[model samples]
Target: MGFEELEPIFGELNVERAGEGSVPSRRFLYHVHAADPSHLRIIVTDFHSNAWEAVRSIVQLEDMRDNIGIGGSWLEFIDYVLASIKSQDAKLILEGGLDTVSGAANAKLVAQKSKGMPVISISLTELVGSAASAAITNLSLELFKAFKSIHDLYREEKELSNQLTKALAAEKERNENIQSQLEQYSKGKKLQKISSSDKADASALLNNGLENSPEKQTPRDTALTKVANRVVPVYRRARVRGVTLQDTEDIEDE
Candidate 1:
């Protein structure tokens, strides 16, 4: 589709066109910002004419734009874009027509670079024919919808994974707390048992002492009672002898 047709669909996006005269051929770049604040950059180029030369020019342009001085084969650009996507900074989609054998091979490499991003592949000759043009348009729309769906699903999956990790951590903490409380309770119960045993032993010793003390002192009490009985009879005899002991002796002699 022409820029006029795609403009309405992606008009809200931040658009930047590269390779007007600076580069050898024409190239367009569109940066789309989603509701989730995630960004997707789409690169449109034609490499069917001179694959190697076009690749070199594209790489140079990219290097200059990013100022990273990246050097390697053309396929390296795909790798760089994939790395950016993996880092979650932005998503990249490569769109081009596969006409020559080199273009097809490069397209395959580009598709492989993207782990899950969609590659929009179209035939250069197809645009000229009216029927093929309609089919391509439909195909483009379907691919865009599919890409959006996949991106949403990926975000949701990441969110769910994070939530599950937090839940697991919370559960582990709760279990640890419960185990600590149980240990404390067990210790308390053991201490109570020890205390009760001590009290029972003391009570048993006290009762044993009480039971044997009376038997141990009974002989001493009996001796004291006998001594008291003998003293009382002597005291009564002294009281009955009123006369002097000498006069009583003389009367007996006479």
Candidate 2:
């Protein structure tokens, strides 16, 4: 028993990465950060009793860099974690397993921010009390579904935006067409009014000429008939296009 306890104490416990740092190290610390914390490593000058366990507790088992077995049994791991906690006055740090790096980072960040303290690793035995796989599998499935749902909503929003662009363009064209038609109608009404007044003036002048002419005098009824004949074709065309018309009577074609 003395041999085992003194073994780690004499051999230097290598201090591997232990704090939040780069991506690779951070990943190592994620799952284990709360369980362990930190991924960087250093060679501790003293203490070999729990050196392997200390490194194992904090070192990431999962990630780009695979955790090679440091050649220690489960019992050795427990000893190392327990010793480190008692020595440092910290919680026993444990191997949190893989997929806990994010949690570790969060815990590490929070403690350092408020308390200005280093990350403390809890013991491994405290964590893996049971071996239930159901909850882990369910969580993985739910994450996949959530990602798929977000992608679908993004696609729908993009399609709706495209449809709105087309509808707005079509509406603009319709308004322009209506505006042009109104302008044309207004010009036509003004011209028609002026033309009708001119016609009345010309008829009055012709009647006065006929009343005063002493030789070969054209009759008022004959002059009016000529004017009516000329106006008939114009009236017919205007009526075809739905314009208002004035009728001339008591007139014969000359």
Candidate 3:
């Protein structure tokens, strides 16, 4: 029941009175202690019980620690803490009978907030010398393990989400680059359209140029013309020689 005795089970413990004061009137005290910020214990007690029955509870507080300011309202803090606790799939161990006012209220609250969480109520007085301590130690360890499982799952989900986001961004960039290249290629490969008027103008220009140019004769025609010129001169010279011979023979006859 002693705070010092439970230190081994819940890490180094710290006790502080609730509310502010220059000599506060309220006797209510709440102990907030933990192994780390992620795992925390909050106990509210009047310190009137002869036995240390603070009903120590643990919760994951690291994620929301920054959001809850030092001067934040009590309701804001309570709402965040309740939300965080309900998210956990851990057990709630009550230290009394369900018929009791506090126990019944807690059970109903659990049912409303977290539907399937298991609740166990035990009488601390029934346990002799060290039974209560042993039970609480075991339960606290189990609760811590459950909280760890949830934390690990959340971390994995965040990492996977980040990777998926990066992949999608890269894919989008790649697709954009490909589209840009395709557009450039299409522009480069485009064939300019030639209008019918332009085509007809080009054809007329070509025909006119051919008509004005000098004509070129074939090789066979040039060869035949050269052969006829040489043969005609030789034939004329032979005819003149024959006539000279005939005139000489007539003179001899006379």
By TM-score, who's the top model here? 1
Instruction: Estimate, for each residue in 59-156, the C-alpha lDDT of model 3 and write its tens digit.
Output: 32222334333245544444444443334332222323433223212211111125542231211222223643554454456557767888999999
Q: Is candidate 1 or candidate 2 better by lDDT?
A: 1
lDDT by residue for model 1 (37-145), tens: 1222232223223211012234333544355444665346445544442342221222343332222232211222244543322112212244434433543575588
RMSD of 1: 14.0
After TM-score superposition, the amount by which residue 195's alpha carbon in candidate 3 deviates from its true location, in angstroms, is 11
Write out the backbone clash pairs for model 3. none
Residue pairs in candidate 1 whose N, alpha carbon or C atoms collide under 3 angstroms: none
Model 1 stretches with alpha carbons more than 4 Å out: 1-134, 214-254
CA displacement after TM-score superposition, residue 3 of candidate 3 (Å) = 35
Q: State the C-alpha lDDT per candidate.
A: 0.43, 0.39, 0.42
Count of clashes in candidate 1: 0
**TM-score on alpha carbons, each prediction:** 0.36, 0.33, 0.32
